[model samples]
Target: MKRKIRVLVAKPGLDGHDRGAKVVARSLRDAGFEVIYTGIRQTPAMIAEAALQEDVDVVGLSVLSGAHMALVPKVKEALVAQGMDDVLVLVGGIIPNEDVPALNAIGVKGIFGPGTATQEIVDFIHKELAEPAA
Candidate 1:
């Protein structure tokens, strides 16, 4: 039987605001994913470690402090270090439109900005996991 998609939704860096992350976590859970939410202030290393330990299929990072460029690459690096690059990485939270290309270049599959629907994020995960590995 196919296992349900396992996702790690994490808040990285010093951002104390968590209402958005919590809402997405809840939404993904309701959408039938096994959501592992690591609460606030998790470093990139901590998140990558947790993702590896949990053996999740996706890593979703929510950063609202305008540090998406710095945080997203660090998380990707950590995933590479752990040989978890096969795990899809998605980032959301206040990302500027100009920064989307750079995020994609660094292996981010989906970028969810403000006003992006919760179902869109969930659907992205579904479609990404369905693709055969490169």
Candidate 2:
């Protein structure tokens, strides 16, 4: 059997809402990915540490507070500092198109906005993080 793709889903900063994060975590789990959800009130450092401890293949940040610009890079930087830079990073939530470039420049491989089908997120993770099928 192929190794299951492992994902760490995090809510960075002070975002009190986690319905979307929980939904996505369930979707990824249903799609055969092992998901670790860190829940709300997480700092970038906390997220990175969880990613390291979980040995995840991807880190998915669910941010709805519009602080992606500030928090996302910090998570990436922390990942780099912890030598977890090889892990793929992704973001999902109310991200604006204007901020997409900046997020990409910081190594976020995929960004899913609101109303994006869970299947789309699942497919993207499979395409980007899953190992090639034998």
Global lDDT scores for all candidate models: 0.92, 0.92
Q: RMSD of each candidate?
A: 1.9, 1.4
Q: Which 10-residue window of candidate 2 scores lowest in summed lDDT?
A: 124-133
Give me the runs in candidate 2 sitting further than 4 Å from their true place: 130-134
Model 2 lDDT per residue over 1-134, tens place: 86878999999999799999999999999998899988999999999999999999999999999998999999999999999989999999999999999899989999999999999998887788655789
Clashing pairs in 2: none
Q: Cα miss at 88, model 1 (Å)?
A: 0.4
Q: RMSD (Cα, Å) of candidate 2?
A: 1.4
What residue runs in model 1 are displaced by over 4 Å at the alpha carbon? 131-134
Q: What is the overall TM-score of model 2 with all chains considered together?
A: 0.95
State the displacement of the C-alpha of residue 71, model 1, in Å, after optimal TM-score superposition. Answer: 1.1
TM-score of each prediction: 0.95, 0.95
Model 1, position 50, has a per-residue lDDT of 100
